[model samples]
Structures are given as C-alpha cells and as structure tokens.
Target chain A: MVTGPRTLAQVSEGDLLAEIFPYFAAHDGLLIGPGDDAAVIATGGSVVATTDAMVRGRDWVDEWSTAADVATKAFTQNVADVAAMGAVPTSLLVTLVADPQTPVQWAVDFACTLGRLAQESSVAVAGGDLSSAPTGTLMVSVTALGDLGGRRPVLRSGAAPGDTVAVCGTLGRSAAGLALLQQDLGALAEVDGLRAECVAHHLRPVAPVEAGPAAAGAGATSMLDLSDGLLRDGDRIARASGVRIALDSELLRPDTDVLAQVVGGAEALECVLAGGEEHSLLATFAGALPDGWRPLGRVEVGEGVTLDGSPQAPRGWDHFAG
Target chain B: MVTGPRTLAQVSEGDLLAEIFPYFAAHDGLLIGPGDDAAVIATGGSVVATTDAMVRGRDWVDEWSTAADVATKAFTQNVADVAAMGAVPTSLLVTLVADPQTPVQWAVDFACTLGRLAQESSVAVAGGDLSSAPTGTLMVSVTALGDLGGRRPVLRSGAAPGDTVAVCGTLGRSAAGLALLQQDLGALAEVDGLRAECVAHHLRPVAPVEAGPAAAGAGATSMLDLSDGLLRDGDRIARASGVRIALDSELLRPDTDVLAQVVGGAEALECVLAGGEEHSLLATFAGALPDGWRPLGRVEVGEGVTLDGSPQAPRGWDHFAG
Candidate 1:
C-alpha cells in the first residue's frame, strides 16, 4: 500500500521481486525462472553468449530517456550481439544496480517494458540480480544467450576477397536522434514527422534481430552488428578477416537521404558513416543477398576499411578515447 | 609502451582491448572469445544462467579491497549461483563500467586476476563489454553459464518433511572477517593465523562449488547458496518449500568455534546465525550425507525457520532496507 513517489529504500527486496516477477511471462525454453538461485534454459549443442552494460550519464541522460527507453536500448544491444553471430536469442539475464533512493517506478517501468519486449522477441526472462549502488548512480547490465540451431556461427573472420558486404535495417538514426536531443530540437517532433521518428529512434533504437540468421542461411561468410558505427564495426571485420571493406557511397545514399530529412545532408551522411548504437546487421555473403538486405560494399585483398577507394580513418564512439 | 599511473582516458579502446586480451587463455568450450559481437560456447542439453553485479562504495570500499579482490568476489558470487542449481560452471561474460579517469592498472589487474581465476575454476572467458561511467562510479557485472550435465536441477522448493539439512562449507567466516575489518583489526593478521584467514575470507570468500553437483548426486532434495546469511536464506527455503527448517545450535558449534578464534565466542555465534556473503552450499537431503557435508538440522511440518525449538527472526542484509 506504499505510494507517493516511493523509493526503493522503503520496500523489501522480496516485495519488489514479487511485484516485478509477474511482468515476465513463462517461456518453454526456460526450465526454471526467477525465485531460484539460478535459471535453467533448454539449449542447443552450442550457445551464443554476450554481455553489455549501460551506465547513467555516460549512456543515457534521465532528461532525455525514460526507464522504458533505457530498458529498450539495453535489450536491443544485447540481442543484436547474439543475432550478429547468426544465433536466435533465447534468453536474457538482467542486473540492475541502482541507488536505494531511486524511485521504485523506474525499476517497475524497466521490468515491465523489458518483459514485454522479451515476449515480442520470443526470448525468455531468466534469473537476475538486484544490488544497491552509491548515491545518484543507476546502471543496467544484460547478458543475452542464444541458440545456434545447428548452423556454423557467422564469424567476423570468415569473409573472403569476393564476399559481398551488405547491411539490413536503418543506420545513423540513433546518432541523429542523439544530436537532436543534444540541441534541444526535440520540439521539432511536434511538427515534423521525420524528426519525430529520428527522436524516437534515438530514444529506443530497434534492430532487425531476425535478419542475422537469414543472412547466415543465405550463405553469409562473416557478420556482426553495427554497434559502434559502420566504419568501426566494418573495420573490425576487415581486421579479423585480414581484408579490406570497400564501401560505395552510392549504395549508402538511401540511408543518408532518410537521415538528411531530420539532420542536415552533410551531417546525415557523416552520421551514416560514423554514428554508433544503430544495432543494424552488417554481413558479408558469398552468394546472393537475402531478402530485405541492401548492398553496401565489397571485400577486397587489403587491410582496414576504404570508402570509394580511399582509406577511411577508424572514427567512432570509443568510451575511453580522448 | 605506456607507464606510470595512466588513466583509461589516455588509451584507445582498441589498444586497451589488445592489452587486456592476452590475459585470458583459450578453453575447449569457447568456440569464440572476445573480439566478436558474441562468443559461442559448447553446451549440454541445458544451460544454467545467472547474473550478479557489484558497485564500488556499496559492495566494497577501495580501502579494504583492490581490483583483483573485487574481481575474485564478483566471479565467486556468480559461479556460486550456478553451482547452487546443481550445474558445472562453463563460461562467463563480464562487463566493466567505470569512469574514464579510472586507472589503467586497475582494469589490467582485474582482467588478469579474473583470467587466472577463470582458469583455476575451469570456466572460459567467453566475451565481455567495456563502457565508461559517470565520474566516481565503478561497477562490474558478471553472467555465468553452466552445464547441467544431464542431472535434474535441485530447486529451492523441493525440500520435504524429515529431510536432513546439511552445509558443505565453512560458515560465519566471512561475517567474522567483515567484523574484523570494520574494527580495524586487519593489522592483527600479522600476529594471528585465524585473523588472517578471516580477513582473507571476507575479501574473497570461496564457495564449495563442486559440492553442489555432488550433493545432487547424493540425492539432495533442495539446495541454495548461503549469500544472505543462514537464517534469512533458510527462511527462503522454508517459504518456498512450504516447510519448516529446525536447526540445532549444538550442531552449529563447529562453525561458531572456528569463528570464535577471530571474533569472540558470543559474536561468532551471532555471526554464524546472521552473517552474509558466506557463499557456502546449504542443502536438504532425503538420504545419507556426502563426505564433505556436515549435518545441521532437519525439515519439519511447518513454515519458516527455528533455532533450538524457538522461532528465529529473519535478520540479514536486504540491500534496500533502511
């Protein structure tokens, strides 16, 4: 019966868990869920695992993002990692470390949205941990587990010279959205449809989570999620495979054109090339492209990434970079 | 090569990762390690997944712990959760979120110690994420995946009346160690072996990890890790299983006696009853006990926990309680 901007400090851990547990629906793969020491999930012969964390102030500002927005972004980031390996995301273990004085509503909103998104994505909500943090701090971390479904993982080191590089889903939208938020141009959303879309994309970016396995089925040689911009992630594949990723700006015009409507044309183009957190699928295929995929570049015998025959500097979001 | 007390801000993400990557050794279960969007690990028919997070200033003070100590404690906590489910830990995905000004040596020390500990524990370092946090914030989260190895998971709600309650590892040592550290008696470690051991236990408590699967093999009805103290965790099993846990303090003398050498007898007795972060295996069995396990009590026809025929209050760390 506690109400009126109640903080976590006023509630018991058991009571909070009881309120949060019902948000996650049961899944067949989850042999056991929360309430136990750990969760058990049915798995294939091989499992794909990855973890990602987001901290307040560094990853998101409360003024610009809600609890739901934070939850959505965290879910997408981890799911996209599993998807990039050509695996179907099966479950997630989430951890929340927040100050005890944090509003209970924030945790409730995050859990509800995350549970809903997990259902929509057909992933199970596994066990998790909750710990108190120092004052004014809030952080969320997610570990996504996936089933490979008997296919060989599409590794970043598998691409060859003749592979056709392609991308599925939107790029630069998140970065453009961030820019708009930074400039306090979010009001543009009230009058402009594209600007609103950009703002929405920045707050909660959606990834083509299923496109990864489709690309693998279509004979993808190498694949990854575009998390740290197209250039940086593309360079990862290039360096891992010991080849060059040569991009054709003409092929990227559609993305830049879409972004240009929200930001300026030049900035839009730059966002498309170097903006991070897009969560789009980037893959190199040996044969024909899969449905919904568009050509972006080609693999060649060289090192690093090139744009229109010129070497491009590896510039993107590096958390520790000066 | 960079030297001196260089901070993370001075290094590129790629270069930092290159420096940290060499610490982890390859394992057979890891199909892919860090450097990819996600790592692939060989799995059995089922996987046990759990996550835990530790925040600086809340979980531990820098004056009492180093990065290596924090890494060890974090790893043990996650692995103990998996072990509590009657599974063998196979791999871990770790995430580090810290301020950019955090020293590079801290990150290196953490990675190296985690790598060594993972090797000792036979767990693979699959992959992880690194992100910058707000000023003065430092957090670490770990998600551990374990193989069930064809055994049914021992749940917390499976204990029945007449089940024998037993513990597989030392209790109260961690709590006693915390008491010593709080009293500034850590310096007594130079003159007392028991005090040194208690201090070490508090800094990096090791759980009886293998005893979990062994207990399952020995027909354990229910089990859990003792992270939140005996009385509180025992109350959890009682509530979950709809039964009562009746403990005999006489059987607990071995634990209290060992703790008495470090902290006085009366305090040691209280520590054995209500101390947290023990990480020992607590189980109920319908059959004979395993070799390393010592009997403590039994399950009865009621709810909650009792000590020597008296109802015991559930007092322990709640993380959010005022």
Candidate 2:
C-alpha cells in the first residue's frame, strides 16, 4: 500500500519536525536552537524585531513561484525590515501553516532553502511553529530579530530639509517583473537580459542587507525599505519628518532607462514611481552619500511628495486597499 | 453608509494601523515601538524566543469564540512556552492574516485584549505584520521573546532517575470544558461555578506564568509547557531524558476528581490524560518541590511513561495527524 508518509496528514508533527530540523544550523552565540520549548540567542543589549507573512493566492501562486522562491521572498521581506532598522539580522523564527493534503516535500524544500539562506547571511533559524490549515490554504510567516551594536536607530522622522534622498538597491524591478508576467506568463522562457532579470526579481528579489548598517554608520538621517512604491514610501518619510521629498527625473534615469528597454518609455516611468516589492533601501543622508547609494531626490520644507514641482498621488501596494 | 472602516477592505493598511497603534503602549526599555519598520527593545545578555500560531477553522471556531478569546488563548499559549523555558517574557511580535471581509472591530478587540494582557505582564507589544487573506480564512501567530536573567535554560534532557516530576498549574480543565460544550453548547450559560469555570478555561486558558522563573530559580532539572496532553508530553521528557516517568494515579485524583465533577469519571480520566491546550508548567526537580508546584510522579530507570507500574500510550494533539 503506502511506502512512506507522503502527505502531511500521513505523518505526526514530531515526525515532520524531525525531518526538517536538520536543515537549520544554530545561530552564532545561540544558547539553544530548535527542538525545545523555545530557543535562546545572545543579544547585544537590545534587539530589532519584525515579522512578515506570505499567503497563497494573495502573495504568490504555485505556477509562478516554487517553495524555494517563497522561502527567499519571505526571508528577504523580513530581513529587509530588520536591515531598514539599521540592525544586523541575527536569527529567524518561521511558521508554516498548511493544509494536511500538502506534500511533505514542499515543507522540506522550503526549509532547505530558508536554512541555506540563513547560513549564507549568518542568521540563525532559532524557533518556529507549525499548524494545519483548512483545505486549499497554505501560508508562511517569518519573525526576524537583529542585533544593533550600539548605533542609534535611524527613524523616518529624521529626514530634515536639505538632506539627500538615496537608494541602495534596484527600483521598480519587482513591479516591472509583475507587469511582464501579466503581459506573458512565458516571459521567463522567452525573454532574456533585463526582462528575465525582472521576472526573477519579482519571484525572488534580493535586498541590500549590509547597506542598512552602512547607512547608519554613515549618519543616515532617515531610512525605510521600498516595500510599497517610491511615492507612497516617500510620503511616509515626508509625513514623519514633516518635510517634502522632491524627486528629479534626471536622477531616476539610471533605473528608468534600463527598464524602458524591457517595457516601454512611459511604462518605465510609472513602474519606477508607483511599483512595489522592490525590497530596496531608501534613505536620506545629511552629509556625503554613502557607498553603493545614489541620490534620487532631496528633502524640502513642505509636506507630501513632489516630482518636478508637481504633487503626485502616492500609488503602490497596500494589502487591504487592493 | 459607513461611519468608519467597518470591513478591512474599506480602509488602507495605514489607516487601520493608525486606529490600532494607540492600543499598544511602548514597552519598558523599548527604544522604539510600532509605526516603524521594526521595534527595538533592550534585552538581557540573552533572549529566549518561541512562536505559536492558531488557524481559524482548525484551531478555533468563530461560533464558539470571540476575537478577545482568540487573543487570550494565543497569548497564553506563547507565553506559557517562554515560561516553560525558565525565562521572563519581555516582548511579543504578533501577526494577523485575515480575509478582507472581516470586520475591523474584530482586529480592534484583539489588539485591546492583547495590549491589556501585555501591560499586565509587563511585556512590550513590539511590532507586527498585517496581511489580507483569501475568502473565509483567518489566522494569528505570536512570537514571544524573553530574558533569562543569566540563568541557564532548564532543558528536558536534564532529568535524572531520582528526580521528582511536578506540575505548577491546573490540568484537564480546558478539555473537560470542551466536553461540556460538545455535550451541550448551552452548558456555559446554563451551568455555573466549576462547570462555567471549565468552559471559561476552554475559551480562554491561563498559564502559571510566574512559576517558570520560580522553578528555574529553585533549580529545576527539566521543564516544558503542558499544551499537548500529560501522557504525550510526559513521554517527551521520558524520551529526551532517557528515563521512565512513573506517574501516580493517587496524586492525579486532585485533578481527575475536580474534572469528574464537571464531566464523568472515565471521561475526566481521559481528559486528564489526553487534554490539549491546558497551558500548564511541567518540570522535574532534583531537590525539594518548589512553591506552587505539587508532585505528580517520580523519574525511574526505564523508558516511556508509566502509571502505577502500567505503561500508558502517549495520546494527545498532533497537528496534522487528524
């Protein structure tokens, strides 16, 4: 009849945990890791904590993404928040809530990918929970904790007038990739160069993990992850700091020019201004721009965001608003 | 037609967050609270971390529980695990994934209850994530972080053959209450005293949060939270410590006898043996039993758990087994 426990329903939670525990290694300076009531890790006086979740249908579909891709996205989304706090991510606690009918292999693949990514980043998979869900439902969430080695947290309220607005990672890539997929599902197999890269970024975008602490060390006035769009996220900084963010089209050309070749001239500008999930670091500096960061705008004495002296509405991803 | 955001989809994520943010107070020694990418909290030299999640259909039914009930249960379940680790819970990161049609009042009620609980326990509500789920789906998860205060974590493997097994909280009340509700959904309002208490416990379980650090201070050799029934969790300690746990039926009468008044004798025994979600602290002590803890059994030179020299099968909640 049955050779092994194939579906999650066929195995006990302990059996599944036993199969997945080996993928995660202990965090640096961890007193305990997994397989216990809880895990323990050394924190440098204070810890930076954040969480993110991805649901099936809402976050991704099986057709465009794999388990590894899901793991990468969840990992980056969480670690990006930690980095945006100007902290070094030290550990993660992941939860997988899925239906009993899900294949056991999917959990294994997700764990393997997450563990490898943690190891590469030197972050620890400390602890997590697993629960069975209703039919046709599978979700994953991550809680990332980071260490701040005595640096003051760079808050969104610190952007003063005359500060330079900058970003350290790609812009509009994930949104453009989503557009490409909407245009053609087979864009990955057909398209090459920037288009393929965009699709890949949409599926599993990379975050400039190290640039966060670098910006903090370089005296960043304000910072945040570009999770929504430039205008929407910029408005957050503007509202918090009580200053306006004035963007120059000439400065965004480095990103828009490249995306134009893949999509179009007009669409590229829209993507660069209103696209989401880029996972890029957006910050403001009072002095010299730090390494790897390019200036895109400036902080002014007004409110909201402006593009070439015109007020633009903030347009991007908002979970419930959509 | 609507005065404010009635349903989640009626408002943006920011507007909803602005409504809920005031419910949480900044934690003691918290450098930064919500309204940022992450929250920063001061910790001891080390931090104890654990996560637990509850799904809508599988973990609860909306007909039987309210949003406040869900928050209380989730809080107790997670803090109980941290208490079991012999640490003081310092902060929590919560995530709520709900369908767009879910009412905003539900979220507000949950935050209110959770914030009150955190304030009572002196734990900070650090930060969290919110995402919209598909139709008819809702879930909540909590990640609790604790401070050890320089004490070594009491591991399950530390039990010796001569140690005394003990528990510091109520037993089988939640399961017995479930039985009452299953027998008659009207048992809660129709019944009073112990029966109503059982039903209330089943709806909102409370753990002996203080006894964990007390047990650790009193030199507990092994410890764990009794979420999944006594027999199954006892077997875990037996397997981990490589010693047999010989439970005393005479000692169990205090629990079974109390539950038998609510349920029948046999059902009470079964409930005491295999009830899940009790949120009690179970431990092994080499010296004298700590205050608030009563002896349940003794560790013996064998494997598995036994009741009065008779082996008992490990039976309890296994998330995917059903």
Q: Interface RMSD values for the candidates, listed in order?
A: 0.9, 0.9
Please state every model's RMSD to the true fold in angstroms: 1.6, 1.6
Give the Cα error of residue B3 in candidate 1, in Å.
9.4
Judge candidate 1 at residue A10 and give its lDDT: 89
Residue pairs in collision within model 2: none
DockQ of each model vs. true complex: 0.87, 0.85
Highest DockQ among the candidates is held by which one?
1
The superposed Cα distance between candidate 2 and the true structure at residue A61, in angstroms, equals 0.9
Worst 10 residues of 2 chain A by lDDT: A184-193
lDDT of 2 by residue, A1-322 (tens): 8675599998899999999999998666678989789999898899899999999989998888899999999999999999998999999999999999989999999999999999999999998999999998999999999988889888899999999999999999888899888887445635477888899899998899999998999999999999999999999999999999999999999999999987899999989999998999999999999899999989999999999889989888999975
For residue A126, model 1's alpha carbon misses the true position, in angstroms, by 0.4
TM-score of predicted structure 2: 0.98
Model 1 stretches astray by more than 4 angstroms: A1-4, B1-4
